[model samples]
Target: MDLSVTGDPVLAQDETEVHAGIYLQKGTLTLTRKGKDFVAYHALVMFASANATPWAAQRVKFTATGPDSKAVEVTVDLLNDSWDGPRAGIAEAIWKVVALAATAAGDIGITYAPPGRT
Candidate 1:
């Protein structure tokens, strides 16, 4: 694949793969911003890349909920970007629900066990 940077330069390129053909990017994206105080809380970026169809995209589709039961989906377009996917581990939680890190498939979604009840 041919990748290039215009102004800024790429720091490093990881040969590691989160999935099959996905690689982590070790670089900074150029920030062309104006003089304005755009108050923000938190932000996230996700990228997905794969050659195989059908199941490839599914692996990157990390879905979650927002403040008001709103559906929040984060995933990179494997076909479009033709690059790496999101961070190796996609962690998302629903509003009012504690989405713990991936321990097991059973420990993915919301928990009704309460704190320290497990």
Candidate 2:
């Protein structure tokens, strides 16, 4: 399994009004089975800043790629918006969800859970 982040250079125009430095950045996390590596599944993530809104999960996307090069994508709606700790913790939670979803869908052999939970 391989994971990587891809960034979009363009900043979100509307979001920049509230959060000046926010970019419409994108990240791609790919999972491939060890023996059958050709069939890869990907999770494409776009994070929206809570600097503008009070939401926990901004946005997330999961993509699956088959051998025929056909791709299917699902948009995930995360509803864990009760965070009152710190702004920095939001990124960690978002990433953990991304990993758990990607690995669960791809069936990549490894068990993944958030830091404190199973």
Candidate 3:
């Protein structure tokens, strides 16, 4: 699997009011299973709201190449909008994309383990 985070989140500042501000982020992920490869495009947008302090939405599309390839795409609003931290939020999003890609790959018998685990 290859994952590349092309766009790092650049938060806009609100000098007058304290808020998380707004930003746009992007990434690409590729996973291979059973001689097939799936490529996913990820996009995220953090929006500024007067009523709410901070909020964000994310979308990912997985495109596959194989005899039995299937495409999976999803969009979620208010995903990890809180102050839990960027690492946690991004991890959650990445896992979601991975799961979606795996599902789209069909019965290729693909399984995943943590790094350094066999």
Candidate 4:
């Protein structure tokens, strides 16, 4: 993927996928994940013994930091904006954060520990 800085003076949208050589916020984020510059985090919450939605609207909340070292919390909506299903047969949960346009917007690594595990 050959990338050339576009002369267009418009900011890229958050939905822009970060492909190889794709233009990203210069001097900010990287093109890969893992050990990435901690730009933000999505604190996935899972109830231990619950059978319904915790509050009603479960939004993915994450905090991103810019070059200035200031953190800003960014909340993204879910597919249907609701998760009122049970947790017994749920295989896994997946969430995606778009191009945040932060000083450095990188995908935060996510891991699940079930209900009982250290």
**TM-score winner:** 2
Off by over 4 Å in 1: 1-59, 77-118
Query: Over the stretch 1-118, how does candidate 3's per-residue lDDT look in tens digits?
Result: 7987777775443322221111113224554555655554443322222343332122233333333555544333333456332323334545444344434432333333212223
The TM-score measured for candidate 2 stands at: 0.30
Tell me how far the alpha carbon of residue 25 in candidate 2 is from the true structure, in angstroms, after superposition.
21
The 10-residue segment of model 2 with minimum total lDDT is: 16-25
Q: What TM-score against the true fold does each predicted structure earn?
A: 0.19, 0.30, 0.26, 0.27
For candidate 3, the per-residue lDDT at 3 reads 83
Q: For candidate 2, write residues 1-118 as lDDT tens digits.
A: 7999798775343341120112122334343444432322444443333444422233465555645667655454443545332234334645565455435433222233443444
- Candidate ranking (TM-score, best to worst): 2, 4, 3, 1
lDDT per model, in order? 0.26, 0.41, 0.36, 0.32
Once fitted onto the true fold, the runs of candidate 2 whose alpha carbons sit more than 4 angstroms away are 1-40, 52-56, 66-69, 80-118
Give the runs in model 4 whose Cα sits over 4 Å from its true position: 1-38, 42-57, 79-118
Error at 14, model 2, angstroms: 12
- Residues 58-116 of candidate 4: C-alpha lDDT, one tens digit per residue: 23444556445666554444324234432342223312122222212323221223222
Q: Which is superior by TM-score, 2 or 4?
A: 2
**Candidate 1 residue-wise lDDT, 2-111, digit = tens:** 99757875432231122222211212111112432222122232212234221122233324333344544444332224433323322232111221211121221212
RMSD of 3: 15.8
Q: Local error of candidate 3 at 67, Å? A: 7.6
Q: Model 3 residue 58 lDDT?
A: 28
